[model samples]
Target: MKNAPTATNSQSTKNNQLEQSQYNTESLTDLSTAAQRARVLHYLQNHRALTTLEARHLLNVMHPAARVMELRDHGYKIITNWRQDSDSAGRLHRVAEYVLMAGGDA
Candidate 1:
């Protein structure tokens, strides 16, 4: 009987969950968009190029194009190349791959 959760324990659990949710939301929102874009830019500067999937997988960025545009607006010289790739099923598709140019903070 002691192992069972009482009404007070249930209310406390709900309160704890709400607090945790608020904390998580605040922490996530505290990461500014500029910081996210900078992560993408740094990856490009070091790795030379990045694709949309690579950006999502490596940097946890949902929209790489948006980040690229932000970097470009900040005066970063970035270039895009359309790459033709085949998937495991032999389906062909085009992907926009981004590369930092030689000039402008490269």
Candidate 2:
């Protein structure tokens, strides 16, 4: 008879994912701290002024605070602003947005 797949197989597969939060911490911090700055002279080049979730998904860094700190320390001026919601004040956990400061180098 053929052997059936086991739960252990599923567990092992999850453990092997490099992009997941656990395995990514150290590796991401290394990569994150390395790509600390880049040229963004135009709208298209901006990193979407990415939201925290987008950062986690795209950058492999779960903690947006850590990534923001690393970027700022490298001389990129991060300007924050409050974007008002249309419906209600309690609609979202975060209302703040960021843009690189004026006169910033590419």
Taking the tens digit of each residue's C-alpha lDDT, what string does model 2 give over 4-76? 2356564333323212433334343454332322211122135546555445445554565554553454344
Q: Which of the numbered candidates is closest to the native, going by highest TM-score?
A: 1
lDDT of 1 by residue, 7-101 (tens): 65654553343334433443323345555566776678788898876776567677889878866754668989999865557777787899998
**Alpha-carbon lDDT, every model:** 0.66, 0.42
Models 1 onward score TM values of: 0.61, 0.43
Clashes of 1: 0
> Which residue runs does candidate 1 get wrong by more than 4 Å?
1-31, 86-92
Q: Which candidate achieves the best lDDT against the true structure?
A: 1
The local distance difference test score of model 2 is 0.42
